[model samples]
Target: MAYPFKEILQRFWGYTSFRDLQEDIIESVYLKKDTLGLMPTGGGKSITFQVPALAMDGICIVVTPLIALMKDQVHNLLKKGIKAAAIYSGMRREEIAITLDNCIYGNYKFLYLSPERLETELFLSKLAHLNVSFITVDEAHCISQWGYDFRPSYLNVGNIRKLKPNCPVLALTATATLLVVDDIQEKLGFSKKNVFRKSFKRENLAYKVEYSENKFNRLVELLVQHSGSGIVYVRNRKMTKELAEFLTRNEIPASFYHAGLDSFVKDKRQKAWTENKSRIMVSTNAFGMGIDKPDVRIVVHFDIPDSPEAYFQEAGRAGRDGEPATALLLYSKTDVSNLKKSFTNAFPEKRFIRTVYHHLMNYLQVAIEDGIGRTFDFELGKFCKAFALNVVQANNALNILERSGLIQNTDTRENNSRLYFLAGKEELFGFQNQRQEYEELIKTILRSYSGLFSSYVYISEQTIAGRTGLSNEQVYQYLVNLDKAGLVKYIPQKKTPTITLLKDRVPENIITISKSIYEEQQERMKRRVDAMLYYISSDIICRSQILLAYFGEKKSKPCKICDICTSNGQQKDLSGSIRKAVLDKLNRTGSTNINELIRDLTYDKEKSMEVIRFMADNGDILLEDKQIKINS
Candidate 1:
């Protein structure tokens, strides 16, 4: 029963012990049992599968929804000398083929692919050939329409059980409600007895909400006062850019990131922020999925998120290094209105969905059956123009279609080529000798790469362009020409996450409403608003205690560092008689001013206010203007 996990840990990652539930998860996988991991952000979720993959007999297949996360995890695994490879949209075809071939030949221990990519014949065929030990689905809540970040592709995970019936499945996510947890198990086809859940709580983060008319100004003051890396999340791309600009104008080194940015630019900005070249990043929800920057001191939400699940996940990103961190939300009545507007925008009418569905089919020039394995470039504006549909309606329809799973949208900057040499060193040298014009380029590539001969490599075309003094386009074309000349094989890269809708374009009348989906989204929003209100109104509970309880954890005492616990010196727990006296004055006097109430009660002003607040919190008093009234 003994394994070399400890040796594997020390030899590769230089770690000695497992974090929280990682060892338990690894053990479960080893025992061929299903597991559901609910570790918080920065809890080392990656190691749960990684250690097990190394210890198991066959390759582990990880299905993730984020392309950025897949690439980052694969890169880190390779750095540790683990045989891991990821098949994502931005990779060239030859690279994918080589990686798939490696899996088929048992040369890789872990294979990461997008859940959307599971339907492809090429991937499925090769996957059938490989002996997969277990399947791990990250962000498992996305499978349920009730989840905050629902995706239709996640529904295909159940089919993995059909493909490899003997293999167990592990579902992992940071946030999920009781209902979401149930749906994930059902949707992923896990047996009832196999599910395992860890507590979802972090004790180090202090959560608080500030109510103010001028939230931006408040944010600036807080940023200037707080020292360390921070993130400010806005709801839209425009706000992300504007807030970052405002912060920079105020002399805070800041950057902005969103899905709308070009990949290269997004990569650069993310690198700058992660490396501490920028201390702050104002971003939309798209920014933090795969990022693991540990020492974040604060997380501010300029606008409320759509649901509590999202809010908890984003807030959990703070204080990951276990030092005390602050989670602040600047709340205004307008944020609630804006959030309602967003919900309407996300869920459109059925006619609109059909219109956009037809447009997409026509734009791609494919029939229903033929579209399953097809991939195409998508232009939102062009498609809208062609159908004479409003841009918002058209975009929302496409999103619905993507959620349903019909077509794959490969959105990227432009078409580009990449090369992966197929020959051994001696054969490559022979080819280079015959093709003398390309000798410098070949040598440059070889010098820049570390394991070019034995492993599948990711050479930066930008670096090759720099060394050869050629435009990126020129370098790409040269690589394609070399492939045609049989010097090396090449494939064009795809840049977007492959999106496939499960059903073809159906009529508006045929679309069925899932009450669970609607109710779930509504409840999610309610939970977030409740959390915001809780942080602002609570007086006796510690800020950290409130947050931890929301995430399903209990703490016996306050953390002492939070605003409530720290202010204990200035305040005392009022006696029940004093609380009743405060309520009685409010009820008898009816709308009297605060100063008059203090005088009438014959109590000090500070203690009187504290008693009034305590009565209000206990639902024994209602405050209006400066006066308080007892509940009827």
Candidate 2:
């Protein structure tokens, strides 16, 4: 039987049709079948579960790792008159209780939450009470150790399934290898044959890898050539700012986005870019998830990503509107060497990992067998400075600990600003009269927000600024003043990561990092780096084909628009010119060295070398180290 899902999709998302496997996945879920969806980024992954949940009988519980994305989806659903809520880390116990209770009693159609919440006793207690229709796991690849971004918390999803034994499950991921796909299904408890995978091919997106020494100049040229909104992905937060500033100085309307920025600033920058106030976003990998902007004509990787899965997802952010688009990866020999070194550095010694753990316990003043299940505001830089530890090594050590399930780290930028009024309305009356300076601000707060006296409320300074006609800074100052005056208890927004101890502090000698697991993870990472390097240096295969093959798809035809295919034509023409020049010069000089030919050529030395190497490899010439001779 056909459901009214098309009508529902139109009502909520205003889309007339579902993309690729969306309708099939939705149908399977609505029919109560365990399903796994493998759609590329921007392939309407949310609609598969959301539309079905809307058509189903009870609330759908969405498990995702991204807390901000969870809240964003809930907010969007609420705006469309669909009751939805999310519970994540940093939320008060009371808030979580209320949200879970609402899911049980308030007829909420959706309850989005992080996978970490599944293991909590409170969530487990409420899980038995929720009238769960189905469970949707986004970023399903994270459950597998083989996946590019593994999260140990996702392992608890199986526990959730035990609570609601009969509820069907839908696992969603944008990029997953064959290994990850099988792992997700097994981990999620798929009942039977239930996998829906769309091809990883994006026909309209031309994947290009260009060798360029001057990346910034090439970036400007590409941005000018492709006249539309785009994303420039860089490796580090500092580079995001620097590259964005450089682009702006070169007259490109650009803004930088990273997890380090205040939530309000991040939102403002994102909004400006999304609305076309800025034509480009220079960002870290954190910027792309759940962003629905279409018509992005280009996506340039300023630095190579850690894996092909990550690269595919990041590049897939372009051309969502289905128009022609370019995904350009700037390549250099230096990038490859540096990336390998960085990966090596990212995995510190096992002894170093244990030492960092010891120092972390000491830094937080936690004694052995104490501080279990406690969350602390952890600043890596501060901890490193205090303990005389290298920041990079410390970070890697923390990651190893996290992978070992010793601790959990939450970036506090993901935490929302919270406020609570300490004084009741009547009690504030005297203070309001005494301090006329804060009277209007206090009045505006009371008028605009609800339940400020009862609990700490998640507040948006931007919303307050709009309501009170004050700048965000001014609004923050007012909250700080209220806190200082003892009229309110305000927690200003956090920009550092929060570390939560999953288990009690143990003896440093007792801590263990699994040798097999560590080796396996390193091998996987090495394979990914090799794949990315192969994509960069390969001139024979289609760029799109290489990506497709990496994801376990075979026999993909060449995308004619990619650099490899297009350059194939130019390469032939350029090969003829270079061959003649080299032959002409060789004949005149009677087999000179390679360096002399390079000096004699008017073309770029790099291009000249590449041409000479290509000719030698193809048997038109013979290269013996520094010497070049025409093959007899």
Candidate number of the best lDDT? 2
Model 2 poorest ten-residue lDDT run? 568-577
Candidate 1 residue-pair clash tally: 7
Instruction: Write candidate 2's Cα lDDT for 245-357 as tens digits.
Output: 99999899899999888777888888998999999999998898889899899999988887899999999999989899999998677887888987898788888988999
> Model 1, 1-632: lDDT tens per residue?
88777777777788999887888888898888888888777788888888888888899999997766876777678777777777755554556777798777847898888887687667887877898989999998888876767887777788878989889888898887666778888887776645556655556777766777888888899999889999999988898989998899998899999877765577778999999999999998888987889999999999876666777789888999989898887878787677667667766776667667766666667664554444555667777788888887677666655655554554443223335677778887887898787777788877765444444665557667788887778777777777787767666555544434444544435655454444455566555666655555556555665555555454334566666666745432443345656767666676667667778776566656755654555455677787666677
Extract clashing residue pairs from model 1. 404-501, 404-502, 405-500, 405-501, 405-502, 406-500, 406-501
Output the lDDT of residue 146, model 2: 91
**Per-prediction TM-score to the true structure, in the order listed:** 0.81, 0.85
Candidate 2 segments whose C-alpha is farther than 4 A from its true place: 419-457, 471-491, 568-632
Task: Point out where model 1 deviates above 4 Å.
Answer: 89-97, 192-198, 367-370, 408-418, 431-437, 450-457, 466-474, 492-632
In model 2, the clashing pairs are: none
Please give the TM-score that candidate 1 achieves against the real structure: 0.81
RMSD of 2: 8.4
